[model samples]
Target: MSEPLYHVSANPHVRDNGSTQKIMLDVIIALLPATIFGIYIFGAPAAKTIVITIVTCVAAEYIYQKLMKQPVTISDMSAALTGLLLALNLPPEVPFWLPIIGGVFAIIVVKQLFGGLGQNFMNPALGARCFLLISFAARMSAFTYDGVTTATPLASLKAGESVDVLRMFEGFIPGTIGETSAILLIIGGIYLVARKVISPIIPCVYIATVAVFVTLFGGHGVDIQYIAAHLFGGGLMLGAIFMATDYVTSPITNKGKVIYGIVLGILTGLFRLFGPMAEGVSYSIIIANILVPLIEKVTMPTPFGIVKGGKSNE
Candidate 1:
């Protein structure tokens, strides 16, 4: 007979010009600037970590699908994207095996075990980053440049110390692989938005909310420089623009996305100002991802001019 069919969505015509492979390729291309800039600053170790992570993630998916008799999806590039995102979130000086383990966890535990891809509740790469961060806090927090270790700008900011604002904007500040460069991250985000790969709603509102929150809750009387530091420092730019915008994990409707962005900003601000962490973008995004279903449910659109009982506008 006939072969079986797999269905993905009711709205089949969306992204008409884009296949999974193609969309993923766009994401990779958009992400390249920050990744390359990161490597340029961090050197061979960063490149090696990224390569190992990507290889391990792809291999994990291949092996899992092969053993389980599932369709092989390595060519879709999701696994590679997860690997790249996870590697970028890692400390540049992280051990070689760190990304290897993180890659496996991202593909096997976070993605595949949850039925893969859009089925997963959270972003696979981010989930893996939090997992590794918890399991290897020391390694994850350690940052080095030119054989000297230093705290990230966020950490220094938390300690009530001054940071080189200009350097932080220029990506010379100490941070994770892809998070140091605000300008490059914004450029990548703009590329995705311009290409219609993503909507600008979430990122705009998320960053705006954070800006307003820090301004209102200013520790030193709410200056523009402090706000900019909070904006460009740590992973706020990366998380707001990229990680929090994951299609599978974020809200679908425009109204739902607005609520999601607001919640993320509030949580991130709370965590940074009150919680014991120097930065809270990862936790904020994860929390927002978990609540996407609720937000969408509440903000779901009604059929045009119709009531709850399906009555017409008459």
Candidate 2:
């Protein structure tokens, strides 16, 4: 009977309620509010950019896997999420081809080439965004609305121009599509935490650290509210909730997570206060991503029946 042609698998007989598909689906849903708000704020150009990015990303992933004779993983929707995130991080006035190039870089260089899902070293979207920022500084820094140029809130702040906090919250600021509305981003972040999709520790610790550091050393003109403004403004919420918490690139151990959050916060604060750029969340998260492996090793949990330097008895 050929041993009944059935085999047993490994232990972990039970599995949790989450799957990659479900988690990715939840993430797509979570991104909706901010995306919709972005379109409303930036109009048709924002919508077109998002669509192009996503299509290019999905197509690129599909074509790459086909050429390599590997099973297509596009059904997982991770590529779509990465594409959308990349688009959201871009300015509305970015050249059309710029997003296509970024999407290809994300789907090919950062993701598929690394063996796909859960194997990427850094968040693909953030990696692509950083690349675009470096390669096209002029386009990346140029903010616009309805074909009219304007200074980003961060740029204004850096240039020592006064800004109205109320307008920033209301999404009148010229910045990246999803970064303009601090209020909307916060609401989405809270939803993700509430749904257990992400840990609150990272967000809380990172934001608090930035707030406190800015308060202490940002300047005599820097007030507590200004620190709060930094927290709620720009891409801080988006990066803390999404990019920093990316499972593949972030620390797994609890202690390591806290440390990662703290370091990310400090770097972000320093960059904003001292660096030329007004925002630092993306850079901070990428820096922390590179340290996750080391952090995990140092903070590894002790195994059962094992001493600090001894082996366990079987």
Candidate 3:
């Protein structure tokens, strides 16, 4: 075929080699270790939560679309991912109906109502997680591990108790379903970075900032265990790696991402140290998601061959 005169077109004239299905599939693979580890730690109840969340989320999306005369797109796996992430953020012992409510809100109100998939302004799972956290603080905060109520390491720290660092690193402690295992979460994060499904800068900066902040101002000053517990004891790893790095909700520019991560890290530190809540990752990520559009706007790169005042830079 011969080249034709340049034709005018709308946006997205070019497409990447990746598809929505392939990207979502990679996310599923990355999340598998943490999801399975969560189930293993929490046992059958955890399994039930996971299955209920996935089914409810997928069904909500399908049914809403069919009723509204829109094409059903649950095959893309976005709803499944949302459900899984929301479940991971929940205490394993929550009522099964909780995930069902969260699933409906996530898909119908958070995702589909905002134009679905790529159009949503915030991370659906984190939004649902925050919603649940607020409305059901009693249930969401009461964590049970091995049939006993336990404060998460962060909460224990706030209560002036020391935690076993090794158990925290492993998956032996109680918290949310997916956030207890720092090792498994790190491995999954590495896989996603290797597969190029996500950039490492966000998680790295977020975690590093938390480490540095706690190390500098942890009151005891420079204690390794103090910093480690703050880093590995809660949802920082899970939120930074999975939810905060969401394509639709996160900044598109590299610089914007770094700044966003820094903001999250600082906000998290403030909340952990001063705020009443023990875990700040969920709140930090949700707040950052809301600011993404503004971050992108400010960090937006100047057009090629264009300079300030509309002059050519070239």
Candidate 4:
């Protein structure tokens, strides 16, 4: 027989030059404005938290990979990204050891133990945040701005106290290190969309859904300040723009993505309005992450030549 010239791979026959490192670098770049602003606003403590968390995450990944005889992938920057995300979620006033503990749990337990990177069932940073939030509620909930302890705008709103919407929008209010600035976070989200790193559907839908939910059921009857407080006064923008859109944890198809956004929006609205906590972004995103598989399964497109019930049309 004549020698064959064609070659076939198992699947994913087409590929692109884009890499995990490049994508992570782009995300890191997108996050810089908020990160720098946070450091400038919170001073050395924020910087310290960021540095320790990132280093701990990177080191944990490196050591674990080495010990397991796996190829070291610390250079990929996923661990660094996870650490940065976790630190941003934390109050800058947290003890130095907190981020270290968070980083270790994020990398070793939520990430590596689950098979690392794409294999993780949830965002590692968020998993760690929830873990820390439950374990150290007081520390995690404390907020400070300009060295003075204060209630976050969301907390004030939850307590029926008037909040300075302008300050919250401008990120001058006390909150987590990175989540205070709505404008800066929006800018970063815009950059991500421009780079095609993420789609705008989830964010837009998620935000819109929250706005409508709060407006209809908030008992404020279209009060702009109340809506604005719910929107810009918490971690909603940060979570919607960055964490909830995580590629591995989010839905892959457009339909699935839209459904995912709705679920996130409703869950967040429920938690913030009815749950004991004033903030719900982290919990909402993590919960939605766990539902991504079901979303994708239902929204998966039928094959070109296949029918709805798996019968061939050809």
Candidate 5:
């Protein structure tokens, strides 16, 4: 018999032109608008945090890989993305060293220690944000805008004070660097969806779930301002659109994604309404990320020619 012309060796024989570097670059590009706006609004402090955090993340990853004798992958831009996200989540007035600590923790502890990028169980940025929040509660909760220390829009809402919903939507309110601008975040999210870098399922469903949850249990009956505040305030938009939709941490199947979104929405609502803190998006998404495995297992589709109970066609 003649030799075969070709050989198939693995299940993942299908391939595409997409690369990790390309996807990361696309995300970074999409984030640029919000990043620039954040810097513009927050001034040199924001710029400093962003620059330092990104550098620290890339440096941490490179140094770790070099020390471990692994192939250095800083060019992939995942570390940079992680740093940017962590910095964006930080308070603009945070000490310069905060992002440095966060970047190192995100890359080394949450990401590389778990076997690097795709193997990270939870979103590294969120995980590190949670860590920083726990370690620096007062610092993380402090907010300043326009050279004055003040409560965030969500905090005002929690304190039974009404806020300018329009201003909040317009990102004029005090909050984290990147999360204040609903319009810009949504624009970035739309760009990501148009580029097909992410599915709209998680972000759309997650936001919708939060809207519905807050409307029902928020003690405000069909109030547009209240619902919009919940939607636009805090880190909900940023986390839902960016971190929750992360490819490695989010569920793969459509069914799993829906369930994950619902879980995130409910948890966020619970935390915001009843917990000690007014913000909950980070914790909610991190919790849901931990549940991705079980969600995928339950929502896994059956193979072709396989019956429900695993009986095959005769």
Candidate 6:
């Protein structure tokens, strides 16, 4: 009798490295420094706001998924990250309930409604932020901390007033918790970049483009150095590094990434200069998110040896 032939079937493939859980964990770790800095700058209220935002976001995600009969994904920590980011983007003195509402919008509407994980069209936290900005402009614009109200860096800059560069770096300014200190945000961003958690293309190109645009305009007797200051002020670093680089919302192709970055920068500059609001990072990123698919299609690489009609080689 002939020996039976032996064959190994390779059908299903499974990939295991780090999960969404792990990636989210790393992101949370990367954000820790800024969180600590925020607490230090804004004191106990900042901590309270952070906690409330996180709990509300997680609760919203859990409730929404449970209601839809989808397996609750809170273990992935994505909701927590979204909550943390939303909190960071908010004024330290914001009412506690506002972030809860934003979180509901983020997890329920922007994230899960379109399909959970990997399927959302835009960054949930940023989308929620944009929504909140439009819905509650008064609350969003009322900047305060520890009972002291002040204009944001962008507002001051636009008003032809000056900011103390040293104080801004030290997080003494009144703005969003994680956005006030350019130095701390850069440090955290660098760590994320070094860990290969995020690409530098967006942040570097975005900031540079803004700098160039502001320089070219040269309005109100602002110089290049002043333009540079604007680059580090407000939420530019946070949005460029975190929100704009959101994997699901950003372009996949290299050329597309550059286009995305450039467009965001230009829009941010235009809004800062001409729009009613002084800060524009959230709006700019959301706009870029909306265009990512189109950008990817336009910038897609040509398929090898394939003509428009799929003609064969001559």
TM-score of every candidate: 0.94, 0.92, 0.94, 0.95, 0.95, 0.91
Window of ten residues with lowest summed lDDT in model 4: 8-17
What lDDT tens digits, residue by residue, belong to model 6 across residues 1-314? Answer: 89999865321111446567777887888888889989898887789878888898899989988888888889989899999999898877778788888989988899888887777888888888888888988888887755788788778888888867677766777888788877778888888788777778888889888888787774844574587668878899889887887878887677888889999999999998878778889989988888988998889877887766668555
Candidate 5 colliding pairs = none
Model 1 clash pairs?
none
- lDDT of predicted model 4: 0.91
How high is the lDDT of residue 274 in model 5? 89
The TM-score ranking, best first, is 4, 5, 1, 3, 2, 6
Better of 1 and 4 by lDDT: 4
| Ten-residue stretch with the least lDDT total in model 3 | 7-16
TM-score of 5: 0.95
Score each candidate by Cα lDDT: 0.89, 0.83, 0.88, 0.91, 0.90, 0.82
How well does candidate 2 score on lDDT at residue 248?
A: 84
Instruction: Tell me the spans in candidate 2 whose CA falls farther than 4 Å from its real position.
Output: 1-15
Per-residue lDDT tens digits for candidate 1, residues 132-242, read: 989999999999877689888888988999888878888987889999999999999999999898899999999999999988885766788888899999898888888
TM-score of 6: 0.91
Clashes of 6: 0
Error of 1 at 274 (Å): 0.8
On residues 38-91, what C-alpha lDDT tens digit does candidate 5 reach at each position?
888889998998999999999999999999999999998989999999989998
Deviation of model 4 at 123, angstroms: 0.4
Higher-ranked by TM-score: 3 or 4: 4
- The C-alpha RMSD in Å for every predicted model, in order, reads 2.8, 3.2, 2.6, 2.5, 2.6, 4.5
Q: Give the Å error, residue 248, model 6.
A: 0.5
Top of the candidates by lDDT: 4
